[model samples]
Target chain A: MSKKNEIIVIGDYTVTQLEKLSEEFQTIFVNKTDDLRSLSAASRKNIKGVAFKGHRPLEFDAASFDLLPELRIISNFGVGYDGIDIQEAIRRGIKITNTPDVLNDDVADVAIGMLIALSRNFLNGVNWIKSGEWGKSGEMALNRTVSGKKAGIVGLGRIGCAIAHRLSGFKMNIHYYSRSEKSSAKDWKFHNDPVSLAEEVDFLFIALVGGQETSQFVSKEV
Target chain B: MSKKNEIIVIGDYTVTQLEKLSEEFQTIFVNKTDDLRSLSAASRKNIKGVAFKGHRPLEFDAASFDLLPELRIISNFGVGYDGIDIQEAIRRGIKITNTPDVLNDDVADVAIGMLIALSRNFLNGVNWIKSGEWGKSGEMALNRTVSGKKAGIVGLGRIGCAIAHRLSGFKMNIHYYSRSEKSSAKDWKFHNDPVSLAEEVDFLFIALVGGQETSQFVSKEV
Candidate 1:
């Protein structure tokens, strides 16, 4: 039979996703990034593209990349492609793509939710009620308020901007740290450095892209 | 000495609050609403007002109101005065006051937080991470999204308006049920009835006043 490898899907994908991908392309399935090594030379040669899913690191070292000579592009399912070797892909004339802005709203919602949860001690309140402590002990202790508080965004990118937009409705004073101030920053205060941004705000949200350069951008010092 | 009674400070009062009230006016301290009957008739005659605190009901029946003949006003410490008998207070020429709009923002923040926590299954995710299920079972099953969803406010009062303002940032289609269309409700759809509003929205927020009329406003049918 002919090699069934126009595309290789790497990492964990739902059955529906796998079926849809197979219906759309000639595909080979691999459970992990390192599984590419097990593919036969003929099958590897037929693989022109990779569809990446899941959060696990996709370490495409030179040796790993060399295994698939016909590889042309890697389409990452999520916004972050930090695990992928960008310089190696560029050097090998391989294209890298990611689904950017697709998750901005969901991510921003989570960020706001987490912020409110922490500020209001939602888990503790739930636990208090569940454990019958609330009935035994009058009321849960009052926690801090999120609205009208100061908030800082570590990276004023698409996701950070989305979070800042939501915080504005809560009447928060927005501050951000970015390499350069964005026009969208508007009335929000911009701090050129993360340290200053962290010092000035009650809450700091880290939204920088995941990569070696940004791995510890909000470090211990910050 | 003159009768030291311009106000009867009832229910739980912090030391600081008791001291503040003492400094402001001649005050009589009563631990409970029923304790009003125990006050000396001479002392009760001098009481002109009441500083009501705590969640316990301040039942002002004819007999209770009759205990303090000079009682003119009940200044409640919270937004809700459901426990105080309004009709009896009004009939006795006694005024009832509450701290309305003081907690609108905080209340709205909590409402949104609870909404996000339920929609995103935040408590379950926390348990998954804590129980180490995330490591063994991969990802948590995806939950519902709050953004771009329809939200209905049962009462478009101050707190409800604040919630709608925040939900607008999430791009939710705002719908409200109120006795009449509020002038402040600009683009939001107004439903004269709560049942119709409940039918059309993904999330329903009840901000109605707590009393007999609204006790079961969002009941089993909703």
Candidate 2:
């Protein structure tokens, strides 16, 4: 019953920082070893927590966890937990954590950049720029204004909320479909159905969390 | 002399929906010309208003205005009006306008996108995606959480405000620098001098109007 917390960071980068936090730490640093079976065979004892990268495909043999009964936490490195089995982890009483906010602005920014580039036909402009279609050149891109464009937000979670807030001043008529009304969300109009949100939105922002609920979304081409 | 108004958009694409407001019978429509030089030449006649692409460079000859005595309103098609000469237009008693509110979401979106792409190394991920690095073997970029990072906003205009609003929920400490304290700004602490703002900011956002005032800002490599 030693209280020194044991953490098997599936990657070493996060643990390097976590180790600096220094609250009596034991970390099993795992970095880019493709075969998890070998690591699982090597590390099936005294594990208290596990942090994993979702990029690589991994599955823990039931026998591995059967031996490591002390494991308590599972921190998914990125925002998604697709790499792990949620129901099994839940049954095992393991708490899962993720990195969410670290990328909100970046993703939001890219979405808008694409919106501007697409609606304004920056692709065409890029062609124009390279071709030296300047002062005496013919017609440029006949682009729609990004300001008054109709926008639909796919999910209204933290990232969705961030996108909506970033879009607040742009004068876009924003439509969103969320699990429930944000009662506090004042600027955007909410819809219960996805099809209805799609009808009016010229620009659609997809921010759905990856899991059983949202895996198939955008499959139909929103 | 008539108080009646007619606007001709001098660009490839015009806001055709703006014509739906014709039911009000206030603003009249002249034909849109995709050619900028021809459009400027046409502005000399009865066309009183013209909108140009603000983000792209436009040719503004004094000779054109020397011909356009009736031109009173010059509206830009996008948010950035760096191309237009405000002083010369003002001297000729021409009022300048831009599609400001429309691009806030778009600009904030790009800014956030750049921040994310830079911070999380999403561009590097893009390199991975482009080079088949994701499917093949490569060193994947792992990022820290965007939450709780120090955020500094350079200006508090509409787009800047939108950026701040979107970032508010991420739980980051917000700091802003403006020429003066914004009357309607909320929650965030303000710093008058950018030196103070830059000293502590981990991520800085540029939202100010481009000019000598904002030029060479964040010039320090630090």
Candidate 3:
């Protein structure tokens, strides 16, 4: 009952994303990667494109690729494409695309937020106020100051650069670790390794891309 | 028996602060403004410098000023001195001083953190992971993007300017409201009032100095 050239959508997407995909293609939706095997043979054969929408490692090796013989593309929704086995896709002439730089600001914002929340004891302060302890206790204990402190960023990618930019406003001395030094990030101090970066700063922020290359990157020594 | 020459310490200071003060002066520590009356007349006569702490309005009016005829200085611990009756202090020939520019970075960091937490729905996302609902639910609902949005700042002072500077990293269009436009903040758009600033931006950060002048500055209209 399906079309001959429909697209396959893997992972749990928002209703809007699903609706948009539905309007564009005769789509086969699967909530989990394992559900792909359960799809009818006829449906799998007709799959031409796959839209991936989750952070889970999508093991699209040669075996999974063989199931969708007509598959030409795997478009990932997020910036990281580590989930997909790129070498395997390349061998089979399958083109892979991911949305990069789209979430840099959001990711950076979260990094800074978490940093401030931790240094400022925001949770404890909020609880103290909500519990009516503020009125009773007179004044809360002073928290650690955030600005003019040293901050280290792991993996100076798009998100890391954005975070460093934000920290500049706080007068923080920026230190970062990346494979290669970025020419545009001349203002910040570059560390050849994560250990040096961590040792030099009061706060360490990890912004590395998720994949085998970065697995255990922040190891025991780091 | 205490020394005739001593400092009057007001408010509930930390033990460390009290210890430091004790080393410097023969101190008369009063937790509350009301407790000033309980001081012995001998101790009252000896008081010269008053280290004022906390936000409670220090009612150093003509009547209270009469109590401490020898009072020379009201040194405020924090930047804002709204609690102290400045006019009465001036009339009584008392010098006043406060620590400023020390807390700008911390306050601005907190403002940005709260904004990100709200826009990103960080609390819900955190709860989902901590409650083990992430394994069951697959993924939480998507949150609104924080960057490339508009931000309004009320009272473009030290903290407000710092917040605007941080938002600029997120590629946000900055709009601010202040009585007079700041020369340094020329890059940002300035609104005559808070109402217009609120209307133009997705998020509004208030960084006004607390006092009678700005008591209801961010009113219903804003």
Candidate 4:
């Protein structure tokens, strides 16, 4: 195979994604990130790049990187790259790329969508109409409105900012908690802590990136 | 009963609303608009005002209005007053009051909510998780995104304007069909007719008031 075709896909990819990638390159599939360790040293030496996309945590620390000597880069499918050890990747001169801001619009759309869904009881409303209760039992119980309510975002990153922008259209009072106050978030109240953000808002959205740094950030107190 | 206490409630009212009105005034309840014909002339003479609320069309034209000689006002419970004949009410020196702008926020919220729900297939996504299909079937089918899509409003009325304002947050390209272009809709593309508006948009919102004039505004062609 040509050097350009020698790529290893290490992660759980959907069947469609897997099929597309497999057809276009000399791709080696591995179910988990650490499965590269089981590959023979000669076979691993041919791997020039890694395409990783999975829901689980990737074990691509120093030990894992040492397994593929010829690997030049690790391209992550999602925005968050907390799974990979950035420090170790930098020391070994391997480039790390993540798809950032690509899903910001989508994530924000879902955040606002879920807020309205929960407040409006859309699922229950659908069930009410489908089960013939709308005609037999009259209208469904009145649901709370999403407009003019207060919403707080835990981490005002790209996704959080997108959500806040969308909430503004609903005439909602926007509040947020972030490591430092963002200059872009004009007129939106900023809280120094998550608990404070949680206290004064009708809905709290956690937009923090996943990892040890933010795993327990929104504790039981919040 | 005092003159102020004499009120007739026409059309369907919730149990709570009926109880509250009954507690405060000498109120006669009629199940529908035409049921006013059943009231005795003596009983109708005591009715100074009418509280109207129903899902069906109100038959409160000249013939129906003449039944209650003492009727001074018809207070509609909702924003739409298409069912009541405004010209007839004016000729009889009777006032027609509707609760307009009261539901602008709520109607706007549901408009955007239903948009997101349909585009993202939220109900199916919820069922996927609830039916253990998320674990068994992996991920559900990918859904279309709402942000940046073209949306057309059939009428640029109060409720349509509210829906348009909310759609702006989703980064949608707003196109609207109105009788006349609105000064308030800054930069939103205006179409002179519904068919022209429908041709260019992904989602079409029928926000026109329900009545003979606009009953078939969005016809088979659209």
lDDT (10s digit) by residue, model 4, range A122-180? 98998898999988988899889889999999999888999999999999999999999
**Candidate 3 C-alpha lDDT tens digits along B72-163:** 99888889787788898998889999999877777788888888888888778878989999899777877888888998988888788888
For candidate 2 chain A, which ten residues in a row score worst on lDDT?
Answer: A56-65
DockQ each: 0.81, 0.19, 0.69, 0.77
Q: How does each model score on lDDT? A: 0.88, 0.67, 0.84, 0.87
lDDT of 2 by residue, A20-128 (tens): 6345566566564343445664565667776666454445435535655787887677776666667777888878788877677656655655565566665566568
TM-score of chain A of each: 0.88, 0.77, 0.88, 0.87
Give the top-scoring candidate (lDDT): 1
Task: RMSD for all candidates, in order, please.
Answer: 3.0, 7.2, 3.7, 3.1
Work out the iRMS of candidate 1.
0.5
> Which candidate do you rate higher for DockQ, 3 or 4?
4
Write the residue-wise lDDT of candidate 1 on A1-222 in tens digits. Answer: 664557999988889999999987898899877898898998898678999874656575678789888889998888778667778999999998998888899999999999999999999999999999978887898899999999999988889988988998999999999999888678999899899888899999999887678876777978
Candidate 4 chain A — worst ten consecutive residues by lDDT sum? A53-62
**Which candidate would rank higher by lDDT, 1 or 4?**
1
DockQ of candidate 3 relative to the true structure: 0.69
Worst 10 residues of 2 chain B by lDDT: B28-37
